[model samples]
Target: MTGITISKGATVIMHFSIKLKDGTVADSTKVNNKPAQFQVGDGNLTESFENCLLGLSKGDERTFELGPDEAFGQANPDNIHHLDRTKFTAETPAEEGSIVVFTQPNGAEIPGIVREVVGDSVTVDFNHPLAGQTVTFEVEILNVEGNE
Candidate 1:
């Protein structure tokens, strides 16, 4: 039998690493010693990211570079929000460079990074931390199982 290749509906187990343009390691499954397992066509990964794995067989290794728009996407200006200091409690102080989760009206929790804390206002960025940045993605396919 031929080895399985990654495709829609395939369950893939892989080791992956992401690095910034400056060569800073962002994340790595290999370092954690935990291979990532996910089914293709699931919302767990972005379309662009999934595209990189398509047609790859087990034991295959590949590296690709993604632009801002293709990766986390260009940072949206509207995602930057300023909130009143009064809204934060002592337990949840809005410290600069800290990440805090804000509950939306729909009960969805969204994480935002505190950009600056002024006297009475705190600037929060709702954009993904990697947004607007180019990144290098490296992957090694450990296994690929097609849907029966």
Candidate 2:
């Protein structure tokens, strides 16, 4: 490990890729030639995911796999809601397998995928797209800085 290792409160700049079980790339920071910057122990990342960065330093490359429980988590049935077809606008039709954004009472927008559309009812799943799937994380650390 290098002197400035990744730990709680450390800032990290890195490129990462998330792959599914079939080796299909789900997401990658390299897509737009932009790396991600974040501080360790931040709520933006799961505790298990952050733990994978512990002791890593600049110029390090690492890969790890996380199960659903440790990653996006299992899909919750309660998150699936059925709404009337009238609730959808023409611009955002309830098409199966399409993702749609809905505004909550608090004004926060959330994305849900249309699972089915039957007659006057539309079923939408609000779970994270990758929920319940195991994923592999590959990270290349470009820089690491200790907390000030």
Candidate 3:
């Protein structure tokens, strides 16, 4: 701890756990025995998430509760798409709650969850799984570097 704090330009290493409102952990670096490493201002983290870690130093532990807007964000109705049932194959059945991957015109892959399978239609939601839900973050900073 040489007066280095978490801020823009700093690379931080930490263990983190993401928990749902009901206290169920959705993900955790500790589960894999690997701490996360990322730059302070990197686009990997949302502005609100980064703000919660500002000014912290090595060995700092904190927990934060984020609303939907500050977390995964509210679900967008436009992200829901209805496709023809014929588009799906038996191997990847269009069953509700199943995750499916779709390719964009630019050749990028995107994942969506099946919401419903009606007569000739399959509805999918492309929004993040956590969208529209509040979450809790438990973080323990292990190291911070590059912030002079």
Candidate 4:
């Protein structure tokens, strides 16, 4: 295992920070001094994102930036949906930033975060909150191996 030796099914622990296009911190495991662990190619991280760590081993740290297309891609206008406030109940508070779960016709439940509330209409955006934004990833490779 010479350079960047990680492989499929490898378990890795990493400290990471994700910054938005505005340079606002979106998420960081390092803030709390805790690291995240996950198996490679398990669909938790995107292929492009995981590819960045392919051969990195323990104690390897790097800061990389990926463009909007490679990151979350441009935001989609179709993801915006308007729903009546009557759809919400006391048990489920309807407010901006509240995640509301709506079931599809096929019985699969999907969640949308409330973006705005006006009169009787509540605007919910189904797109990833980070969608369309260029992002910077600061990562520290804690461990790497080919063993699943």
Candidate 5:
């Protein structure tokens, strides 16, 4: 099997780190001790991030800096929603940092991260979590191959 570069339909195993413009590490596979697997153009990654991986081989590492728009896009105020506190349970407290999943019409569960906990209310942020922030990624292309 020939190893393909970052083309559409290619499956890639990658270890990546994302840092904010303020130099804070927002996410990193290195810290989690696990790699991520995704197909190209799968919407799991931004186009800019995918573009950066194009033509890279195994063991190759590249870093990219992207603005908010190029990354997760600006954080939309509409992505924030307040829910009633009664909807929470003792096992799933309505507290900041707790994640809640809502069922969509398609029956897919979308997770919203809790942003605030207040009396009779819980604020949930449906944003990508990295939105509204400039970010840098240190990525290592673990593997790639043709899928179609």
Candidate 6:
């Protein structure tokens, strides 16, 4: 570990910023003064995202562009569902553009965005909000701990 570098099983501490094609920042670790720390090859990050960190060392900065498929992935039509409005009460109205969390049979909580609301029906999209969009990812490696 003379010169630390990011690789499989390595622990990494870094700051990252994700932005859309229109330059709207989707997320950033620097904003809260808290850097992200994770192990390479872990399920915490997408494979493509981890690939971008490979070969990076402390103090190194990089920027890369990822297509929709490589980032959040293309939106699946099956992820869109229409539900009866009766499911939502006055306190939890299914208003357009709002997000709601639904529980799955396996006890997983899935968040869905309300796309449209019509008479007694609501269209909700379970796909990630960043799905189907190109994105720019920037990162600054702060620390790298090899698995040696």
lDDT of each: 0.92, 0.95, 0.93, 0.86, 0.86, 0.94
Q: Tens digits of per-residue lDDT for model 1 on 1-148?
A: 2598889999999999999999999999988799999999998988999998999999999999999988999999999999999878876789999888889999999999999998999999999999999999999999999987
Instruction: Give one digit per residue, the lDDT tens place, for model 3 in 2-75.
Output: 56889898999999999998999999999989999999887988899999999999989999999999999999
In terms of lDDT, the best-performing candidate is 2
For all predicted structures, in order, the TM-scores are: 0.93, 0.97, 0.94, 0.83, 0.80, 0.95
Runs of candidate 4 with Cα error greater than 4 angstroms are 1-4, 103-109
* C-alpha-based local distance difference test score of model 6: 0.94
**Residue 27's lDDT in candidate 5:** 90
Deviation from native of the Cα of residue 10 in model 3, angstroms: 0.5
Clashing pairs in 6: none
Weakest ten-residue segment in model 3 by summed lDDT: 1-10
Give the range where candidate 6 is weakest over 10 consecutive residues by summed lDDT.
85-94
Q: Which parts of model 2 are misplaced by more than 4 Å?
A: none
Q: In candidate 4, what are the lDDT values of residues 70-134, reduced to their tens digit?
A: 77777898999999999988866679999888899999988888999999999988887788888
lDDT tens per residue, model 2, 2-52: 569999999999999999999999999999989999999888889999999
Q: Considering only N, C-alpha and C atoms within 3 Å, which residue pairs clash in candidate 2? A: none
lDDT of 4 at 47: 82
Q: Of the candidates numbered 4 and 6, which has the greater TM-score value?
A: 6
Please tell me which model should have the higher TM-score, number 4 or number 5: 4
lDDT of 5 by residue, 1-148 (tens): 2367778878999899999888898999989789999998899987888888878877788898999999889999999999998878886778798888878899998888999988898999998888888899989888887767
Q: How does candidate 1 score on lDDT? A: 0.92
Q: Which regions of candidate 3 deviate over 4 angstroms? A: none
TM-score of 5: 0.80
